[model samples]
Target: MPIRLTILIVAGSALAGCSWAPPVQESRTGQIITAPANPSGVQRGPHGETSPVLLTARKMIGVDYAYGGHSPETGFDCSGLVYYAHKVNGIQVPRTAAAQFRFADPVPRDALRPGDLMFFRTSGRKISHVGIYLGPGRFVHAPGTGKHVTVADHRSTYWRARFAGAGRVKTNYPLRTSAVRNPR
Candidate 1:
């Protein structure tokens, strides 16, 4: 064999061996890649497993509602619940309900999806109340002082009339990690 051709072959083999491989898994925000054991144990809402965001919100149900409270141990206010819900999922959102509404992208009612923020006018003012969409026309929220966090239907007369708008918090997380480049 020619000396030049042999050197070229050896260099090519060395380069191939040195090639860098991507991670086996990739991490992302808002990716619902796992199927959580249905707490209700009953199939409800959209089929398949729930998104991590919604699951986080569901876990907070029954937490007490405290005025201006933001901690789970101390209870949660309307916006506080919103903050906690997204915070647990690694999404940073505005603290106040009104600010959250303004900060997030507007999502139409028809296009509403789980984990989206739903705004309302509880005090007859614009964007006064907020809740997390729980799919199947239901939402989870801290209604008011003395009340515990609860899930209610979106079509209820109170919410229906007071409905202001809805917003979506976007994240970079992939939907599935099994096929993800890097799990972390």
Candidate 2:
């Protein structure tokens, strides 16, 4: 074969290979990772308002768990953390864990999403503990005195055995609305 013809064939083959590359598919769940087309939409971080609440909660890890404390610079208890998180996110929530659990819609364990609150009976008296679900069976919370806010596996023996229930705060935006005509 002529040298010029060989070079042309090689160049054509490279371009053909590039055109045949497979399209990427994103996995919304599980460990086989894939990148989404709109990276800003699903990427986890503080960049977007929806997931910033979780980022703020995560930033408080290692802060002391002070009873009745609500300020991030000071410390936080279970309810205080929940209250502060929602408050900063522009959502109004009850100050105590029990009350917070009451006003939201109940979510099944299997259906829990990030930002959903999980309640537990640490004292065997009431919903004394709570955590923010971080998806894939993990949650963040201020455990108790001598412990700091942290993330833990939901399937852990400690949390799994004491699981009370889960709740989702209703956003101000209604699911549906009726149309109305304007008066002239």
Candidate 3:
């Protein structure tokens, strides 16, 4: 067999038993292995108003999970929640999880900041579910029909098994400001 092919087979063998090792983590030597920056190459944030995006999403906590829903009156699906949140905040994103995954900048699980998106392959090989990271390993998502918008433990068994990588949106989110007004 060729040397390259032989090496590939040996490497595969070494990892055949263990399943997942997390998308990223701090090495014991105190080094980060996968702290990639935003693929868009832009660093300024809150350009799309992250706080409004999250606030809008929080207001939707009890909204039903409708397959094609996009509004409070209609409820929301997974991607729909992301869409509505961004859209209402003056930012726009694709309407489906698969499309959203393809368009956003890929992120390591450990480098996730609040307002970053977490994806999942709940049903098939393709990305299916989407949620917004709310820091501290929590995310908000519209689970499914008959389910309401809810907070989920990102590290739980069900989610970890289905855990896909994270994505960073290059939006002007949370609306940062340099001015503070004193209360009269």
Clashes per model (N, Cα, C within 3 A): 8, 0, 12
Q: In terms of lDDT, which candidate is strongest?
A: 3
- True-vs-predicted CA distance for residue 128, candidate 1, Å: 1.0
**How high is the CA lDDT of each candidate model?**
0.71, 0.70, 0.73
Distance (Å) between predicted and true CA of 42, model 1?
9.5
Could you give candidate 1's per-residue lDDT for residues 34-129 as a string of tens digits?
454343322234566455766666666666789887766777899998888777778777788878877777888988877788999887575788
lDDT of 2 by residue, 79-101 (tens): 89987887777776778887777
Off-target runs (Cα >4 Å) in candidate 1 are 1-49, 173-184
Could you say which candidate leads in TM-score? 1
lDDT of 3 by residue, 1-100 (tens): 4554355445544543253243478899999887543321112244533455665675567667899898766779999999899888777788888777
Q: TM-scores of the models, in the given order?
A: 0.68, 0.67, 0.66
Listed per candidate, the RMSD to the true structure in angstroms reads 21.1, 17.8, 18.5
